[model samples]
Target: MSGHSHWANIQHKKGAADNKRGKVFSKLARYIMIAAKNGGGDPAMNLPLRYAIEKARSVSMPKDNIERAVKKGCGENGGVTFDEIAYEGFGPGGSAIFVDILTDNRSRTNGEVRKIFEKGGGNMGGPGCTAHMFDRKGLLQVPALAVDEDALMELALEAGADDVERLGDLFEIRCDPTAFQAVRDALAKANLSTTMAEMTRLPKDPMDVDAEMGRKIIRLLEALDDHDDVQSVYTNAKVTEEMMGS
Candidate 1:
């Protein structure tokens, strides 16, 4: 969870800057649209949509934008139909990479992804090539000062969490996706604040890379994330503070 927390902190900082530039709005919209399409427009009845909207809000995506995306998915504005796809691959230093994409044009997305991988010194692998090394889990980050570790552990476990780990100044709680809301609710009831909560792919094992390789992998991930069609990019690369600072 140390590695997970480090990456989460980095992402939180990066996301703040990206939101100011509206760079993350597009991705948030796509996620909202897809969630609505899959689970209907009612967030109350759709947990996934609820989660998507929360994520969008976390990035400061405007309320108007969120509503519009929901409407688009509900066919109110005749939005383009998007298909969700996951691309798996190996990046520099044999890092396992997983890319989530939303697009109406499969051929275009494939070509663009391929080119980015090539340029980043990586190669796209067949579906399931890298996905097998990961598991879908609900992750929650709680600030260290918010609660005592022992008490937090008891609460999380009683609420059906799988594990809890201390990461620097945060508590990382892992739970089954189905139990995410329950655990979140329990924490909230206890007046605990969460820095972030989401159902994300967790790597079974991480690959450590030298500073140079770490930079290359991060660049590759950033480039993939920058693509309009890419929703999110997950990797098993263990990036150190020294590597990130460098």
Candidate 2:
């Protein structure tokens, strides 16, 4: 598994996702509101809002909460304004790291994020430094037992997927961001169920690190992920299975 994917599976195994379900919902709500606010309240006319709504629905976020967020974004309930921001930095082993944030207070968020990087033995960099090292892609993970590899590969490729890779007990479907919805819809039409689906940044060249450095990087990633204002964190550090075990 890729480092980020492994870490996500670890979090799921640790029950962190379930434990922090409320926080997850809140983050999803913020994403929906921002999308709606930027592109208008109509999901049909708003790509970002549609993606946000689908992500929320996949996680079983309450319908009422989703609707409320859309309304708030449309200025129906005097919603709080938020700004989307990105932070770049280097973690252990000089591995590049990128963070996506949504916050009402830029200064406060900047201070807090900077402290996190400093505390994690990292230094912040100017914008675009690390962003250039990654590409945004639509990723879907389906359990191996749920679909035949040959069938899925053929189906996904025909449905506009870039590749279907077998990673341990899961099959990862990757595609361009523009084809994300279409690929997903195609899989659904074929009655394939995915365990995880989302559009995320993938490192173009993952940098390998020693176990010690890997641990340090994981610490920094986790710390950043725990912050309420942080929506996502991407890193070029690759963690081996042995390092993960250690």
Taking the tens digit of each residue's C-alpha lDDT, what string does model 1 give over 1-246? 446434445555667778877878988898999999998999999988999999888777889999999999888899649999999998898888999899989999999999999999999999999999877889998999999999999999999999999887888999999889999999999998888888888778867677899988888887888898987788888875566644
Write down the lDDT of every candidate, Cα atoms only: 0.86, 0.84
**After best superposition, candidate 1 residue 222: deviation in angstroms?**
1.0
Best by TM-score: 1
Candidate 2 residue lDDT tens string, 40-133: 9999999899989988887778899999999988888997599999999998879899999999999999999999999999989999999999
At residue 211, candidate 1 shows an lDDT of 85
The numbered model that scores best in lDDT is: 1
Model 2 bad stretches (over 4 Å): 1-21, 240-246
Instruction: Give candidate 1's error at residue 79 in angstroms.
Output: 2.8
How many clashing pairs does model 1 include?
A: 0
How far is 210's C-alpha from truth in model 1 (Å)?
1.7
TM value for model 2: 0.91
